[model samples]
Target: MNGPALSIQTLDKVYANGLKALDQVTLEVRRGEIFALLGPNGAGKTTLIGAVCGIVQPSGGRIEVFGHDNIREYRKARSHIGLVPQELTTGMFETVWNTVSFSRGLFGKPANPLYIEQLLKNLALWEKKDTQLRMLSGGMKRRVLIAKALSHEPDLLFLDEPTAGVDVELRKSMWAQVRRLREMGVTVILTTHYIEEAEEMADRIGVINKGRLIVTEDKKTLMHKLGRKELLLDLYKPLEALPPSLAGLGLRIAEGGMRLVFTYDPAQENNGVVSLLDRLREEGVKCKDFNTRESSLEDIFVQLVGDS
Candidate 1:
């Protein structure tokens, strides 16, 4: 618990078809921190998770879970890791309690009904413990997956799209639970497309593109390094052309000619937005109203992946 919960060193994966799924990927998850992995489709997010969980074999490199090498010490490493996959594939005829308890036994842990009961209660699944998996709703089934993952009290938990297709209320509740898990000193690593989820829960963010890690930094640092602020100008009237004096200002027309957008960094010496507006006035250009838009995680993802 005092050291890194998970570590990857030059991890690489290549399929039999000669396609590279991961390229020299290296990262670490600190104890008690939420680490978010962000990427577009086919960016190797699932592949990376698979390798660490002992599902998919890596063509090269090493992964360690709490000081145990994933390949050499498969059982010891895997015993410390719990992965809740994106898909719901529980046995339909199995009762919730049976399935969760069985998962703990798979890791060679003795049956501890108390621990399983507590996990079910924490996930709000205790009431449905006797019900069969098929009788549970989609959201409830997802919660069962979470309970199974936590049955053994793993030191590191991987949540792959944990909130996908879940209702707003349930998603909020799940995030609160995850925060509590972090407070208990468990490392949480999640892969998600929901930018707001990462923005809200993650202590650090790692962006992957084309099977390679673009960068990994503290959430605030990543935002400050790549995020841009935009000023949106709602034009009172559409103009066919721009005036000569406003030529130096970088302004883009958007929303089918109904708006003009300008992008700038607020931390720079001069944003030039005030000067741009002054120049627009000097050139007889008018606008009805204006608003500012801050760059979101999605915006940064788009920019980074697009550049790569």
Candidate 2:
């Protein structure tokens, strides 16, 4: 409440076989914001989450939740944190209501059936409250997991690959629910393989690769700085090869030579759009139509990780 929702300092991890899982990683989650952690597989996303939730021991460094040191004050720190893991490890025969209620009890909270009911409803799981975990479909079970995590009413929630195997509709539903959670003053930190998820939902984004945090910035800043934009020129006639005059420009033939694509950084003062058009006209290249598109988060992710 006084400081960041979660603060991680100089975190490090190494395994028995001498595998370095994390390398002096440090990060902080701003209060009441949706912070998305993006990384390729085995890039320490899960390990970072595990360390903060007291599942995996950090080889070095400190972690605090709402100003409480996680190691020295485990209970107090953990009480403010909730984790929805990627795996479905719920009891197979347990009813949804019972499972969620049991989770609240594990946190030593008083039984609040009204809260549980509303939680179920918020997750669209109220109708399935009486159904056992094994009897529900995959998406419904995922919802149950989220309900269980929020049963304790934590100030901070960590969602690891929340929509990995979910359908498109369910994924959208889950994202909407997360946004509502943020509106309720809950800090949500999520790891996702879907680049669009971070682009759409996150206020800030942190990129990790090879056990280190490569970069962290506001989503808009990352897009404007590192993201590229493309100019797609539709040619009136197909060309067998790039024209000699336009060869110096970073233009590529696409759509079976009927289109010329020029990619440039939007942050730069000169994007070369005018120069490209002038050069094309001078070279007797005719353009039928044209459109432009900004580079997506996926493109930024690939470029960042590739460079690192």
Candidate 3:
């Protein structure tokens, strides 16, 4: 509701090959909130993150991190944000402790071994701290990346595909750590392919497609705005086709006429379900059972991208 911790105003990016990567994208990430950017591959998510983190330069527009312009005040703005890249590009021979420590030093921060210790411990990387990067498992390496990102104590952190290719247990642990980070007052902006992760962790959701930001709103608001639930009626007997009298009701027959699926907006003032059932009885249609199912974020994402 207030001024966001990070702001992207009319952001645009174009590659040398004349491909547009971002198109006047405008977004705001609130302080102390977990914001998830959801999109398909090549949706410019990584490019947007790279622009804000000073990795890939934007062709146009402004990025402000907590009142500091990312371009003009590069050092100060960068010091306030940390990025955990999708790739695990840690130094193969460097110990986890050394690598995390080195990342902190890169930010021109004074040595704070205690902070590094706590970060590693919090990420469940303390036991692996002494192990070389190449010697650790893929999951451990991912945690080390997170620890390194938090090494400098940034106010904002970017996690790009943090749970990609990880096991269920590791993913759960990572989600728990993300919640802890938000509780610790770190504003987290993550780009993820896993809609479940966004649905589970994010306070707000932003959808991007074809280098354009389609929507950004509260997670619940987005879900409510686009989510749909269907009432399915299992017919006791199979019918050759839907009766002509029920044709105007917008119901589709399924399972070779043994089932009928009716899609209706639950938010509407009147669902008209009872009337439809009454009409069905008039048509001699009897249902053995009925149930409802809700749509998920994945459904919303596909619809949004398709429309965009």
Candidate 4:
């Protein structure tokens, strides 16, 4: 309760096909914070989660959940965690209420109909509690998976692409639900294809690629360090090439030469932006308008994963 919600040390996992899915991947999820794990396809995001949940055995490593050794004390470590997997695993014939109620029972938790009722209400599933899983929409089914995951009331929760098929509205609703969970002191580790989701909610971010943990840092710090900002100048007249005076300012002609794009790192001491503006004035280049844009988490993710 006082230490990390989950701690993984030198984690290594190699499949029987001789594919090494994880390479000395080490990470820790802080208590009561939302940590986002970002990666591309076949990047072992799920494999790492599987290893922690005891669904896949690691070739070598040690894991601890709330300071309890994962391997040496698997049950104790597992009981404090909950997983909402990528795929929907709830039974088609089971009613929503029964499915969630049964999940809580699996953890040896006593039946609490009042708590279950509140959970369903919070998720907007109260009306459909008696409906079978097969009758629900894709988004509704996904919500059921979340309901099942939360049924046990674990301190740490892993949501793997939790809103993949959901619409924008429903996705926002789930995001609100996740915030509520964090407010209740649940430490969440989320893997998502939607980089904006991480941008919107994650307190910290971790990037994994090619079976290796590439970087981990506070969300804002990561963005400030790796994210670049661009200043786009809308020229009054089209130019075939950049002015000679602005050659080294990282300026490029775009929009059929109607615009000048100056890419710079705002975090750097000399971002070349000020010099570029001064040179434009000295070189008789006139711009009707100019605007700056900071790279989003998606841009940084693409660059990081691409380079990794």
Candidate 5:
């Protein structure tokens, strides 16, 4: 438990068509932490996950899961990891219970009905255990996927876009479900199209772009380091233009020139918010209301991805 749940050092993956899917990737997932990997399509997020799960072999470097080398000790390392893939591969004719049970058996685990029962109940799939996969809704199918991943009781789980097409309510439900997994001491690594979901659930975030990891940091620390604060002031009257002294304070006239937006880095020693306020007073730009908003994870994500 003292070691990382998953670790990769100088990992590289190249495809037959000369596509470099992964390039010298290095990362570690702390035990029991929910680490979100953010990236665009074809950014190697899925390729990275596939390499660790053994579906795709790396061309070079090492991968260790729970202290076992993924290639040398494949069985031991794989037994501790469960992957919930983006695509559903289960047969349409398979019942939920049987499918999940089959997954456990594939891992060489003896049938444990009690554990399976509890798992199904926890994932809210108990009632649908007898139903075929094709008969279930998309959200229910996703739940079955999660149930299958946990069937063998893996210490580390990979969720590839767990709630990709889920409704708002279902997305929230999945967020709570993920939190419960963390409570059960299951380390989770997830990749998602929704940055806000990552913001809401992740303990740490890693931004991957162009098959390379650009940044990885604690959520709050990352936000503080890159997040900007916008102070929006609702004016009492519309202003024709900005004064010269107020120009350099990152001021922008918005809302049809009725509002003043002051953008600044909140982490700086002197952020210039006080100076902006003083300038507003000098210009007699009376504000009816003012509110400050910190940049969201989505904001930083967009900035980092840069047109992705």
Candidate 6:
């Protein structure tokens, strides 16, 4: 709590098969902030999370949780953290109440039925306390996982693809639960395929690509810096190809040449919009109408990872 919720300095992980999962990755998660780690599959998102959670050992560098070195003080560091893995690993025959209660005890916590009861209720699992995990639906089982994670009342929580493979309604419900957890002062770190999840929830986002952390910044800043805006012009007549004069102007023919799409950075002093319009006019290109659109997180992710 003195420095940050979690800190990793020059972290590196190399598997026995000579696969470099993480490459000198350094990151900091501020206290009480929702930090989203965005990356493509096999980009080491889960490997990084696994390292910090002590499930995977680092090959190099240090990881500190709340100012305590993770390796030197594993118990203390682990006690303050909770994890909801992407996998469903609960025992099929175990009742919801016993599963969560047992998880708390695994952390060496005393039996506090009141706390456990409230946690189960908060997750909407109160009515299903006596039900076996095998009988619960996918969504309800995910809720049980959440309750188990929070059984010890950790200060930091890690959710690995928390909403993967869930229905739209269930995903929305999970998002609400995450928001509630953040409101309760739990610093949350999540890895999600849904860029919208990060866009909607993360205060800050870190992008990892091919085992490297390519970018780390506040969500708004990341968007403002890398987000592209587009102006689409509807052509009066379709052209086979772009005019020669309009070359190197950052323009593209779309909709089978019935439209011209111009992408530019909004922060630039000259976004080339006027220049493009003037060039279009000089080229005798006729436009019936036009509209503008902003880039989404998915756009930025594709661009960044594509570049990598």
The TM-scores of all predictions, comma-separated, are: 0.81, 0.82, 0.83, 0.81, 0.82, 0.84
Q: Report every candidate's CA lDDT.
A: 0.87, 0.91, 0.90, 0.88, 0.90, 0.91
Task: Give model 2's TM-score versus the native structure.
Answer: 0.82
TM-score of 5: 0.82
> What is candidate 3's lDDT per residue for 3-116, written digit by digit as tens?
689999999999889999999999999999999998888999999999999999899999999989999999989999989998877689999999999999999999998999
Q: Which candidate should be chosen as best, given TM-score against the real structure?
A: 6
Q: Which segments of model 2 are wrong by more than 4 Å?
A: 230-263, 266-296
List the candidate 1 regions with Cα displacement exceeding 4 Å: 231-263, 266-296
Span of ten consecutive residues with least summed lDDT in model 6: 295-304
lDDT of 3 at 151: 90
Clashing pairs in 1: none
lDDT of 1 by residue, 1-308 (tens): 46688899999999899999899999988988999998877889999999999999999999999999999999999998888999888799999999999999988899999999988987888999999999998778888888889888897999998897888887888799889878877889999877778877899999888889999999988777767889998888886665676665777778877788888888887889989888878877788999999987577788889998
RMSD of each: 4.7, 5.2, 4.4, 4.8, 5.1, 4.3
Better of 3 and 6 by TM-score: 6
Residue runs of model 4 more than 4 Å from their true location after superposition: 230-263, 266-272, 275-297
By TM-score, how accurate is candidate 6? 0.84
Window of ten residues with lowest summed lDDT in model 2: 294-303
Query: Per-residue lDDT of 100-218 in model 6, one digit per residue for the tens?
Result: 99999999999999999999888889999999999999889998998999999999999999988888998889899989889888999999877888888899999998789999999
Q: In model 6, what lDDT does residue 144 have?
A: 92
lDDT of 2: 0.91
Q: Which is superior by lDDT, 2 or 3?
A: 2
Give the Cα error of residue 39 in candidate 2, in Å. 0.6
Task: Indicate the residue-level lDDT of 207 in model 5.
Answer: 85
